[model samples]
Target: MEGGRWDMLEWLGPDASISVFNYLDNPADLARVGAVSKSWRKFVISNQFGKRLCMTLCPEISNFTHIQLWKRYSHQNASPSTSMDWQILERAHIAYTYFAHCFLSCDSDKDCIMTCIGASSTDRFPVESIHNTLVPTDMDHMVYWRSSYWSSAGQADPNVQESLIYHLKRGLYLVNEIRIRPFKAFFQVGDPIYSAKHVRFRMGHSKF
Candidate 1:
């Protein structure tokens, strides 16, 4: 049985030991290697093997565990360049924002809500007229809103009034609510009529 195990391990290829050690050095590699085979996937996730895999593949993983993995790697490896670090941080921010948006927009959840509005104006009267015509006559602006399950369940407070005020001050028309979720809602705001198209509104996000 030991000889059989040895032969099987041998059959895993000449680089099998290196591959295993690589995973031990940086477990993040499992993200890619996991797709290779069911046996490999099992090996990657197995507690006895997983720690080594993480150590082996830690250099490459970029999902939610990126920061922690990078921090550990940095202790043993040269610190990454500032530009690379910034890029990673930016990507993490985007991921967080995306997750937040998804959470707040998921259906049947009402814990948070968001609203937005946008508008534009042109110098040429004729061009402005044409643009207005393309938009709904009744809607010189657009608005979107979403409510999360938690908010609806009374577990959290709503900020509909503050959101409305913010948009109105910027001369944006509130079109409608786009989505609602447990964490957020999105709304659309339009620019004020006769405002120059070049005069972009200073848009921002605020928790209400």
Candidate 2:
């Protein structure tokens, strides 16, 4: 409050505060404001402000879920930049929904699901290998989806399904060999509206 206009910042709503803070060209300035108080900490953790800042600074991020979620949470008046393509928006929405579901599952422990949402290359990681090779046979965990690649026919291809199942099975087997619990894995190929150049992949772990 000494050297900064703290009173003005305190007057703004969460979204507006973030917008103003981000408008400052210096990252150090943003950090200073963020260190103000517990309320500010909450805003930072919730991504209420950082996400908006990102969207405002980089229009491309408007097509990401974190920004959209921040907008929805804050009820901010900001709109997606005019430059954002509708097709990209649609795909990002779908991907966000899938990720939201996965987050909910993780939070509730209802499904014991952990999702990996992103391009195909992004989701291709060895979980069992990372987890010391522990694999559960009965419980399945791991859903894969391709949001960028969709069939011209509008339905998912049998080949994609087969490939998902095969890799998932292999992954499970690797886990099993290490005595790890198996969690159900699901792979989705998201609709074309959400992805163009890259295929999105999602993974879910089920409790039952």
Candidate 3:
């Protein structure tokens, strides 16, 4: 009976429901929960879901910093998306949360030397452009690279493989998430933005 009652998520109340939701580590799980009901969807969108993910993954991501980030970017000039777009907000929160969590986790271990493994894209607009695009940066302005080759950059075409490989400088590190930002084409005067339909990452000590 207790288990059945608990399963009635609506009974959890706004506060309790949020507490329960916060326990979820997977971003996809969070998104799925919102689809369960209209109330849940509202609750998920209103709450700083991304911030919660970061806090759960790495407690060091202080509430202050997270709040400031929300205050600044949460309402700023969203180039690719509208400022009020919930999906965009969720995406930003998740990405930043991961970035912060990784940064803090790396710092936690004194012995861990967090160094950037050079990234090599299958093809770039110019040689070595990958270096500038993928480097770790502050919360504001994530670096991005646009593929120069039209053939390789086409979206939803599996035949076009735009691969990016990052070789770490020999150290054990815990990787939680990677953020990939598609160019908004904000540079050109009202050009359409292009993004990959699918993305995959592989990490292990082995030769494929």
Candidate 4:
């Protein structure tokens, strides 16, 4: 009503309003926009604008068909009048808001690995230590990272699993993709490649 303070949503049609909101890639900006009015808040949450922005910025998670609230008992505290559908949308809104912010807040241009915590199993103490994985590239043809790659202890059963933990450069990071190149034992006779059939990643805080 006053100078420069008018509800744009009131003047613009739905399509135009959506087109305008589409340009906002920043999570903070989106949050501020939603706070402008109750209608704007509903529009942002109901349409999953945060999720759309996150997928647009991080293509790796674009395949996500659904998202659930991480805190299981959070729903128990909700008011009785809050419908399940609205609760779901609200969960998505909160989750995606933080998710997008995690991605945007970090400096994606640099390496995020700060240090290796430990591996579930290492073939050798120093030679095949999980620390070797930190090396970006091979140093010399003969000797590199003391052995050039990390190796897990031979497992009796193929079903056995191994894992490596690392401290990230920042406490919060959105790891959308991981690239792993299996180690090739060039010095060996057959030059066999050692790799896992599949790999998985997890993130969390370290216990003191």
Candidate with maximal lDDT: 4
Q: Distance from true position, residue 186, model 1, in Å?
A: 43
In candidate 2, position 91 carries an lDDT of: 31
**Residues 101-132 of candidate 3: C-alpha lDDT, one tens digit per residue:** 45555354432323334333423445435554
Tens digit per residue, CA lDDT, model 1, 134-207 = 23222323323211111111212333111121232322122224432122222324432221123222334544
Q: Candidate 4: where are CA atoms >4 Å away?
A: 1-16, 58-61, 72-81, 98-120, 135-145, 155-174, 186-208
Clashes (N, CA, C under 3 Å) per candidate: 65, 32, 0, 0
User: Which structure is stronger by lDDT: 1 or 3?
Assistant: 3
How high is each candidate's TM-score? 0.19, 0.27, 0.34, 0.61
Candidate 2, after superposition: displacement of residue 7 in Å?
Answer: 4.0
Q: How big is the RMSD of model 2?
A: 16.6
lDDT of 4 by residue, 18-133 (tens): 89999998999989988887788989988889988988877776776876555652546578898889888888787778778877765444467888889888888877788878
Model 2, poorest ten-residue lDDT window? 170-179
Q: Point out the higher-scoring one by TM-score: 1 or 3.
A: 3
Q: Which candidate model has the greater TM-score, 3 or 4? A: 4
Compare candidates 1 and 2 on lDDT and give the better one. 2
Report residue 202 deviation for candidate 3 (angstroms): 0.1
Candidate structures ordered by TM-score, highest first: 4, 3, 2, 1
- What candidate 1 gets wrong by more than 4 Å, as runs, is 1-19, 22-24, 53-208
Query: Of the candidates shown, which would achieve the greatest TM-score relative to the real structure?
Result: 4
